[model samples]
Structure formats: structure tokens, C-alpha cells
Target: MKPRFTALLTLLVVALLGGCASQPPLRQAKDVDLARYMGTWYVIGHVPYFAEKGDVATADEYRLKPDGDIAVTYHYRKGFDAPEKTWAGKAWLPDPADTAHWKVQLVWPLRSDYVIVDLAPDYRSVLIGLPSRKLMWIMARERQLPAAEYQRLLAVAKAEGFPVDQVRKVPQRCEDLGQAGFEQP
Candidate 1:
């Protein structure tokens, strides 16, 4: 009985700690332009989860597949010595309110939320969020942008309550870009 109580107490503590962890919040699309929003985006920021706590310079691209469903590819740079890690998934627009925003039903659909938040005026960059807003990814056409424009977007993200530091600079791989389709106009 003593051992069992100790184990139960430990489990409770872990659960409580987990609950207290910070996460990105669910955000509404201030505005969306479907045509401009379509295309690949490099992930810049996300709330940390236990599995990939030390990842950096990660990015993701979203494309509308030939069949109309959405294709998602996640890329992460694990430590300086390790090669980038990549994963792919499929998603679709589910909201009757807006077709531009979507819900991805990947193998581990419940594990992540893929919400398209903001899009560039010219459709160059986009902001996405996991369902819980615990994770977010900002993608752009260029690996780097003008400092002023970048700062403006960062401010927008901050107003939305995301950890701005999580938005890191992702190194572009031309080979990967070839795999992602052009942004729909």
C-alpha cells in the first residue's frame, strides 16, 4: 500500500506539471486570402512539447495536392551535428465558415493542430497554429526578409500571444522546395 501510494502521488505531480506547461492559444484568422495563403511556408515558431524540446530552425510547407487535399511537410534541424528531420501529413478544409483555413487529419491528427492564421498581403508568408495554439509555424517564400517587414509580422504574432523567440530562422533546402508546389494565385 505504501509503494502504491508513492507511485500514485508521483503520477499526480507529473500530471499537474504537464497541465501548467505554457501553450500557444487558439487564434482567429484576423483575415485570410485563400489564393495568397496557398503554398509552402517555413515554420519559424512553435510551443515546445516534450518530444522535440531542443529543436531549432524548423520549417514546414503546405501545398494543395493534385487531388485537392492538403499536403503538409514538417522539417526540423535537430542539434548542430544531426541532419534535418522531416515528416509529412495530409489535411483538408473542414470549416463551413471558411475553406481557406483547415484541419489536418494526419496519422496522429490529435497530436497537432494545423491552423492557417495570417497571410501576407501578396501571399508571400503565412502563419499557422496547432489546434490548441500550443504550437505555431510561420512560413515564407524567402529564407530571410527585410528587417522592417519581419519585425512587423513578429509584432502581430506577439499580439496573438505566441512565444516570439520560437520563431527561428530556417535554412532553405532547394531540394525540398522542389517537392513543394508553387503557391496558388
Candidate 2:
């Protein structure tokens, strides 16, 4: 009886693990010029994590370091009058063959996948996705994206198997920027 129970438990564990790992591998952009990709990008929309929920005027700044790693700074405010928040991190190419696929280390020893799934020809907009397709961010060079462009990005994300309805738009009010001392890009 004991042996039978142990075998059943092992089978259950294997099943659970397989289910958790069933997500398809994310596809990354064919070629990304890391130099052109570096700069400030406004977060127009995202499937928010706990830390970024309710955040407004969200933006990410990237700088290429001498060591080849990318320095990252995430900036946002909770509300129009709320205090500004900033989180610093670093990103590096895990596979030398693919510059579009990166591992972002926001905290020590805890890295997350940062794949560039889509990029505009002019480098004015980008769509970033995770391997699980659970997290996504649509960012643009300007603080606000045109309505048509915004909808187009949403469609692309939806087609990629992401929950597009859950993607909340980040508020980029002029008043919010004036207080934060950020000029329009």
C-alpha cells in the first residue's frame, strides 16, 4: 500500500510540473541594434505587476555600459500628486547569438526574461514580452501613442496569446509630467 501511494504521488507531481511548463517559447525580434534601442521609452501600456500597478507617467531609460551590460532605470508615480519612484536594474544578453533576447536582473540573483517581440521600423515603439506570455509592455518614444498605433499594438499582443484586456494604460498627463520635470519626448 505504501509503495502504491508513493508512485501515485510522483505521478501527480510530474503532471503538475508539466502543466506549469507548457507555455510556448516566446519569439524575439530578428535583429535588434542595441545602440539604437538605448534611450528613454515611455510605458504606454502594460500587464502590470504588483509594483507597477496604479503607476502613472511610467518610463524606462536604458544606457549601454562599457562592460556591455545595459543599465536600466524605471521611473513612475502612483498618482498625479504622489511621490516619484525609481527602480534601477541591469540587463545582459544571455545568448550571444540573439541581441533581442535579454535577461534583466532587477534584484540580485533574480533575473526575468526581457524579449523584444516587436519593434517599429523607426524605433519609435516597441512591444516587450516574457516567455510565459503573462507579462507584456507596449512602450513608445513619445509620452503618448496615437490612438491608431495604440490599437494596433493591442491587436499584435492579443494575437501573441497575451491577455490584452488586462493591459492597463499608463496615464501620461501633462500635469503629471510638469510636476515630475520631464519634457515630452
Candidate 3:
């Protein structure tokens, strides 16, 4: 093989490998108040999922069940004729440094990644983060929040280095399939 050709091939390989790597900064919330974080949250936006975008006007509600397990309610309206779909799960704090961090095991005992990445000053809104930062969610306590508030959270996310373009408005009702999930308090 010619030396020039070998050099070009090596550069191409390096570029391809670098492109395949994931980029997510390692940062956790500094102060998390679990109690204030609990409540029903409507999914305003989230990272896109290629497989299934089946829920719209999605909301997640959390409360301590009488049995001591954190009860989670995943609700979404599919369409006008389709009734809302609800999935329940249990979550528990696995780390002490940040009680906001929890592991949620659904019906199959499979744990979905969960992290508290953004919050409002008074704890009225929140953003959930996945380990890779590729998956993120913007949530509000009410189904409808002020436009200014939503934009404010978007700015915070951009400042934190999230891919803002990937964020899109989630449907308000199952009339359209939107994505949503619960964030443990």
C-alpha cells in the first residue's frame, strides 16, 4: 500500500470512531429537596424515541404508597376514542449523596435510568436526565405552563450542554402520542 493512501485511511478511521462516541458531561444536581420534587408532572418536551412515540399529553405522578414503596403513575391519552394508558412502578433511592437519584423498576423488574437535572427556583418545574444526556425531559406540575417558563427551562438546559434541537413539544393529550415518564422525588 502507498504511504499516502495509508495516511488517508488512518485519518478516516479515526474520524469515524470519534463520530460514534457519545458526548455527555458528568454532572449531578448540587442540592436536591426530595419533598418539593414530588407531584404530578406533565411532559412538555423530551428526547425523541425512534421505536415508539405512543403517548400524548403524558403526565407522571408520584406519592409514597402505604406499603412504603414510592408509587409511580405514568399516564397518557392515546386519542379521543382511546382511553388513557397508565403504567405503575416503584422507585427507591440508591445513593445518599443525592436522594433525587432513584432506580425505578417497572412490572418486568427492569430499571429505567433516572436523574434530576433541572428544577425551578420554587420547585414548580423539573427536567429529567438520562446517563447519556441523549434522553432528557422537561416537565411541569400542570398540564399547561406559561410559555415564558418553558423557554426559561430550555435556556437552562442549553447552558448545561444538552442538545436543544432534540427537544420537541409533547402532545397534551393521547389525541396524539407523546412521550412521558416519572421522576422520583
Candidate 3: segments with Cα more than 4 A from true spot: 1-26, 50-52, 66-68, 173-185
Which has the better TM-score: candidate 1, or candidate 3? 3
Q: Write the per-residue lDDT of candidate 2 for residues 95-174, one digit (tens) a residue.
A: 87898988776555456678898888889999998767777899999998887888888888888887887887777885
The sequence of per-residue lDDT tens digits that candidate 3 reaches over residues 90-141 is 7777765666666665444245556777677777788776655556678898
TM-score of 3: 0.72
| Residues 1-185 of candidate 1: C-alpha lDDT, one tens digit per residue | 34334334433433343345365544556566555556656554344444334554466667777776778765665554568776666777676466545655434413233556666678777676544434555667766555566666667677776677665444344333323221111
TM-score of each: 0.60, 0.80, 0.72
Instruction: Show where candidate 2 strays beyond 4 Å.
Output: 1-21, 174-185
Using TM-score as the yardstick, the better of models 2 and 3 is: 2
Candidate 1: stretches off by over 4 Å: 1-36, 51-57, 79-84, 109-111, 165-185
Q: lDDT, candidate 2, residue 99? A: 89
* CA RMSD of each candidate after superposition: 10.5, 10.7, 12.3
Clashing pairs in 2: none
- For every model shown, the clashing-pair count is 8, 0, 8
